[model samples]
Target chain A: MDNTESIYEKSVVPNTMGTKSFNIDNLFLVAFFGGVIPMVVLGAKNAKWLNISKKLIYMLIIFGAALLVTKLVFVAMITSGSLDLDNTTLNISYRVGSVLLFIAFKLVLNKAFHQHMVVCGKMEALLKPALIWIVVGIVVEFVLVVAVSM
Target chain B: MCEEQYANDRKMIEHYFSMDRYEDARPIIENLLLSDPQDPETLYLMGVVYLSREQYTEARELVQEALRNGYNPEYAFFFIGLTYQEQKMYAEAEDAYLRSLEINPNQANVNAAYGYLMLLTGHDEKAIKLLDEAIRIDPDDSAVNDYVYRFYLAKNDGSNQAQYLQRTMEIARNEQEKLINIAVYHLVKEDTKTAEEYLRQLYLLDPTNKHVLEVLEEINRTNHMLFLPNRLIDKIGGPAVFYIGFIILVLVLTWADINSIAIVILALYLITAGYTWLAPLLYRLFVKGKI
Candidate 1:
């Protein structure tokens, strides 16, 4: 009982409230990835598992385009010196691009495998990509948290 | 025998009315008015025509005539209220809306308008209750939902913020409008990254959007401030950091002293700015490539 209590005190007790010392801004960085990581993993995993190369490409392109645009916009805003704390356009773009990419990737991969390739027996050949995509999402989110908190 | 003709003309009158051809509907409605000058439906049509033509005074008169002639007056009352609202006569508008509610409480527009008036008059609690009812009755109405969302935001009631924002998002038609709510929610919740994502999407979707442009700039500045490196600033070295470099350059014209400080400061500034600029770029270029 003493050993168990000591372990608990050293480990879980400190974080019982699940609140971090990070300020509100840091909290935002964590939350931003909350939506992002899921989208990324789901997107990549679905593309691989479904064998939807075209759709994957579309997703990647949209994602890249969105990120690129956001980077430019952020730079411009900072230069101009009129940054709002509650700007929502960033989140919306990520979500929109993620969704469009998901649909496009899934459809294209399914079509490619089903139409041109000669898969004799598997109905679920693309599960690996889907699982990997989920992992990627988690990792991305973790990295974002670290970046903000660090 | 006259029933068939009455039905035919009523249908034609309604059909023309629905098509917004008020002038075309006039003859049919006028015949009905001639046959039964006290006809509520006929009076209502006449009022509508007058209302469409910006003849508010005449419309009010006709609508009142319809009410006195034993017309049900619910629709007429709604129009009268609308006229009063357009005229900016809040008191008269409120009275008409109250009269409308008395006849048919299910009319969500009346409820919403009444709530708006109450809000304007500083009866917040009552206005919110009425607006809540209005939303309940017409969940699909974007205008009413937006009003409620703004109300909660104004009150700084963070708890209900998400729910109202979600409603606004659901009803928003365009990507730009949808981004506004997403940004606000993430912003209030202090989720800057997600807020940034939404802002980015808006910028891409509509580069000319001033709102998105403003937010992008804001987040970028905050991100820079939050992530700035103390080491980079310190590299500027003691007294020379702010003034001595400039002073030495102006007074002594010593190239070495000026060059050293200038190089150090310039390098530090570039590295700081570069890191600020390149951090996301590097993330997107190398790390996010897989995603």
Candidate 2:
């Protein structure tokens, strides 16, 4: 091959498909308001956009389920007088739990999130989807908490 | 000419262009164009020469002609973007950059250029994402590093600014760039005496650099002691710091069962947060008259 042809080959990359995903900052905002459920749901959606492995998506769901179960168990214990915790301590524990879930969301999807931003350079707005998910998550969380308490 | 001879001539032209000896390459480029006026590669290289000479109209026409003749469309579009940007035709520049990016989103230079355009147009959030992507794609690109450093500097994000400034310093290609980075490094480190020394050297090298003069003036105007509070807040008092601090305060109050003392501490924390948010703005207004 000629030098010019070789240089062209080196410089030109094959065109790949680009897909838009929700911004990580918006996902963080969802997590702050609606906690683990909506965070995992939105993260899974982003994983789909990024074409992340299905196995990683399953792992994320499982991680979120485990955190929810632990929260439910903690609530049940508190309601049954088995673990006597004051209001201040309970508030702190809830904050810590939310933070842990948020960290997990970040760890599981950080690479894909950055890759999406780099490749797409634009993100789908999260407002409508985030609202729907957060409302659904809140209702389900409320029901589970009430059931656990009973 | 034989094919091999033509290849050798093209190689020689490329060598001259790479070394920034556009004048030396011009005669050969003219000959190649004279022999085969429709050759896309020759047309593109001639476009680059025009671009270097600030002949934007000729550069754009040649690049577009190359694109029509099936040259690398992504690179042609990127070159078109650069010409438009130099001419301050921002909307056309953005369109050209988007076209280039649409063809190959992985291009680091296109991403950085688009990010800079976004920054100029006041779309800061989008600029941050695009610039971050460019850095991820090519961390060694000094131009992109400089843009990110300047972005962080404008936001008063001292940690990020320091990080990119160091990267720019490490990859500085020329003496002027190296001198500027070193001076800014010392300035950010609050070593005004050392920074002034380097800035003076830079001033002697390039008397037309207004940034050097402005920084020197600012250094002369402000007392370092009075600026300490503002600098410290900018350096270590971002939102994440305050949020973590508040979390720790809550944990401490709960664990220690110090309700009465907690009120005083919380009030003090609020005051600190307020000061952290306001100190830089107040300093700019009072000291620099910038805002």
Candidate 3:
């Protein structure tokens, strides 16, 4: 069938509803943009299907603290005039380190939290918004990286 | 009892493999191999596990071993084709898939695989034919239908793209694929209005679908479609032209006594605006020609 005919069919096609569609790709995309945090909070807020344990939160806190310390050290080094790295190099390293830290924190926390999941149902709806944000975030990040590197 | 145990082990392997627990399935395959290392079926299953993990080299080796050890050569060849496909060795994949097809002419997957390879190599006609055959072999198989639909989409078979995309959605297993396809269906149909709707629906379904978002962005940015400018001109052009012409007419009427001076002034205004601005505006208004 041609697109035009199909479009016509779409208009006339009767409603027989039951199935729900969830966008998995979008869920992944949103994760990149801090969309994952809110999404995970909502998904776990009920604690029915998946539980977010205190240990996972502690791990995240530790990761955040470590990241803060790293930044402080870098700043101290720059202020003390001890480190002799070029501005571009230092900035790139800082940016990349921040990204890596976040990735590591996420991976570790995800492993901790998702591993003990109770099989409740699909998580697509929860994840979709986050995924879109993630894609947008990645694109922006990529553009920034290219600009910065250049 | 031992035979039953062997069968149960194979079943367990199959179950784990299906669930994508390849690591869990590996031990079972190893146990089966312990009993009879030459077990063709076990070897084939092992090969499939590797294939699923995208371990192409090991998959090819194991599948070839399965064939040598007298497994279902049809499936073994098909798996070999799959491994080759993963490695992007299209010619080898084609040869392996064809060999499988020769053994089992009605095998849907072999035909589908071959059809996909044809698409990769730009053999559109052959790809469609093979995919059609796959669909013929398994009419109720949504995946095969999806392949056929996507094949048409790749060929840019305008109407067919819509039809198959719709069909693919109808039998689509997930809401996400269904939503994405609906937008795609409208998109291929040149029904941008509907396409954007579905694309938005797709975003609501799974917001991270960059492809859907990108397509939506593309559609949103492309407002100056060929018919749009003409329609816009039809709506406002008459009044605009009349008003502008009236001013010019008045200028000529009042300045006919100083015709040479009036003509020069008009020419100056036209030249100043025409090449630098009006021509570009008109070009944008009419064809939306872009660099």
DockQ for each model? 0.01, 0.04, 0.01
Ranked by lDDT, top first: 2, 1, 3
Descending-TM-score candidate ranking:
2, 3, 1
Tell me the spans in candidate 1 whose CA falls farther than 4 Å from its real position: A1-150, B122-124, B140-291
lDDT of 1 at A126: 32
State which candidate has the highest DockQ: 2
Candidate 1 C-alpha error for residue B16, in Å: 3.6
Model 2 chain B is weakest, by summed lDDT over 10 consecutive residues, at: B234-243
Q: For model 1, how does the per-residue alpha-carbon lDDT over B227-253 read when each residue is reduced to its tens digit?
A: 445333335632113223433443343
lDDT tens digits, residue span B253-291, model 3 = 555787677667667545543343243365566654553
TM-score of predicted structure 1? 0.35
**Model 3 clashing-pair count:** 19
Residue pairs clashing, model 2 = none
Cα lDDT for residue B243, candidate 1: 26
Candidate 2 interface RMSD, angstroms, 1 decimal: 11.8
RMSD, candidate 1, Å: 25.5
Model 2 lDDT per residue over A1-150, tens place:
132112111121123234457766446557657877788888888877666679978887887888788778888998999988764666556555655566666666665555444333467889899999999989999899899999
Instruction: Give the range where candidate 3 chain B is weakest over 10 consecutive residues by summed lDDT.
Output: B237-246
| Residue B106 in candidate 1, Cα distance off native in Å | 3.3
For residues B182-286, could you state the per-residue lDDT of candidate 2 as single tens digits? 786676556888989898898898786777898898787554554555455446743334445667886688579988877888887777656654665777787
